[model samples]
Target: MLYKTKGIALSYIRYRESSIIVRVYTEAFGLQSYIVNGVRSAKNKTNRIALFQPLTLLDMVVYHRDDRDLHRLSEVKTPYPFQHIPFEVAKSSLALFVTELLSRTLKEEVGNPHLFRFLLTSIVYLEEATEQYENFHLAFLLQLASYLGFGPENAQEFEDQLRERSLPFLADDAMTDALNTFMSQPIGTPVRLTRAQRADLLDALVAYYRIHFDNLGDVKSLAVLREVLG
Candidate 1:
């Protein structure tokens, strides 16, 4: 069967001599793996490989087999043309880190429309955002936690901890308000978090995920991401 779907490229690896295996999170199917043959020797290598980039949003037509494990791509093209995400170093690095995180965490083949929209919007927000890059990844981490059912329940508790830690970044009223909204609302609402609030929220969320998802283990890229923010 042939299926056309919009997908986000999560990761890819070289396969055999000249082929590649790409993992993508599709809107219709939760997660899927596809094989692209002869990409290394393709005439338009640059354009062809660009579609497999980490977190690249693409529109693709794939040959789907119900009983088979590997799928084949018939055609692919970028769907949400990124203007700054693929070009800017900081933005691109964050994209890579987030894509890797999602590729590891999202293991189900069940359709999740809310998670799909959240990721799609987050990428666009990151591309257009002009705020300090320090908090972008943290905000994403927190939101992802909420989507995964681990978000914090009490803003006052989070705020008290921030106060005890003397985190100056939480002084912003808007940031506080966003954190409050997120803590108060049901999981999956779009709450705008401040850079500082985002950091604190992410710290709490990481702890929660670590407690819940044992396989998360230690995120090595976390140190690199922190270094990049610093």
Candidate 2:
């Protein structure tokens, strides 16, 4: 049966000569993989391939079956075309990191309305914010950890979790203050940190995530994001 759902495009890989298998996190059905044909072919002139870009917010009509692992998209269109992410290098880099993180962590095939709304609002927030977004990904990771059931409540708790897991955390004043701000404040809130401190906080967060997700290796986009943001 077909259903209309809002989805966030997570990632995709080439399937055949002209097809791709794309994973989308749908509001109605959770994470799903869809095989889309002909989007990569030269004869396909509709440019539909752009619809599968990372973190694209899409409104879709899809064919869903409870027993199927891979489903099909009947129709899809961007609900909110990004105004700045595609144009700004830092934002684009952050989007890639966010995409990679989500693709790894969001694996369940069950709908989570609260988590979905968190992700949707966060994405829109990143896209709309014009300044002080370099810390966006850091704040996002902390927020996402809460939704994932392992988040720290404050800077002290963050350090405690690291100690509890035997994970290394830099005990720097700047890093602690910045993390406290990130944990206590909402996304887009202004916070100050040096380049080195920001990098340290990111490493600490990734270490925290690794404690929970055993197989989450080094984030592939981390180097690029660091370079672009710095």
Candidate 3:
């Protein structure tokens, strides 16, 4: 079956030095992998490799066959260019972190239009925000928790329960309040947090994930993201 869908590029691995197996999350097809041939060669002219960039938004035509593990692509192109995240060090690291997280976590091959829209919007938010982006990954993760079935929307109550449970990684009162604001506020809301506060809140969010999910394992990009954002 041929399907035209909006896709977010997740990751790709080189094959035979010229081709790549690219994983993309599509609006109409959930997570899918397509084998893109000969794009990495020096003599290539079609510029197919550009569409495989991490977190790039693309309009794609893919051949989907349930019997096959790898699919083929007939068309792929960027709908628009990112304004800044692709160039900024801190933002790019965060993008890589979340992209890896999604690649590891989103395993099913089923369509979800709402989840697809949220992912697209979040990517745009990362690109368009001019300031206060130091906490973008933390905030994004918390919002993602909601979609994953355990959002801390009732911030104060959730914090109180965590504290009562003696969760050692729980944030202090002021940071907890800031997190509450983060949970309650919409994306693009101005947020200010000290480096230490950001780290604390990020730890709290990771702890939240550890409790709710299985195998979210180490976010290796985190150390680099903290060093650069700080």
Instruction: Give the candidate number with the greatest lDDT.
Output: 2
Instruction: Check candidate 1 and list the clashing pairs.
Output: none
Runs with alpha carbons beyond 4 Å of true place in candidate 2: none
| Candidate with better TM-score, 1 vs 2 | 2
TM-score of 3: 0.91
Ranking by lDDT: 2, 3, 1
Write the residue-wise lDDT of candidate 2 on 39-73 in tens digits.
Answer: 99999999898888889999999999999999998
- lDDT string for model 1 (1-230, tens) is 78888888998999998789999998888789999988877464465877788888899899987677789999889967778878877777778778767866888775688988888887777877776444556566656767777665555655554456554334357756666655554334465654445555555545555555768777666566555553
lDDT of 1: 0.72
Worst 10 residues of 1 by lDDT: 162-171
Cα lDDT of model 3 by residue, 56-148, tens digit: 999998999888878999888998787777788888898988897788778779798988998999899888888877777877887777776
Q: Mind sharing the TM-score for model 2? A: 0.95
Query: Relative to the unseen true structure, what is the Cα RMSD of model 3?
Result: 2.0
Q: Which is the leading candidate under TM-score?
A: 2
TM-score of each: 0.78, 0.95, 0.91
Q: What is the lDDT of candidate 2?
A: 0.89
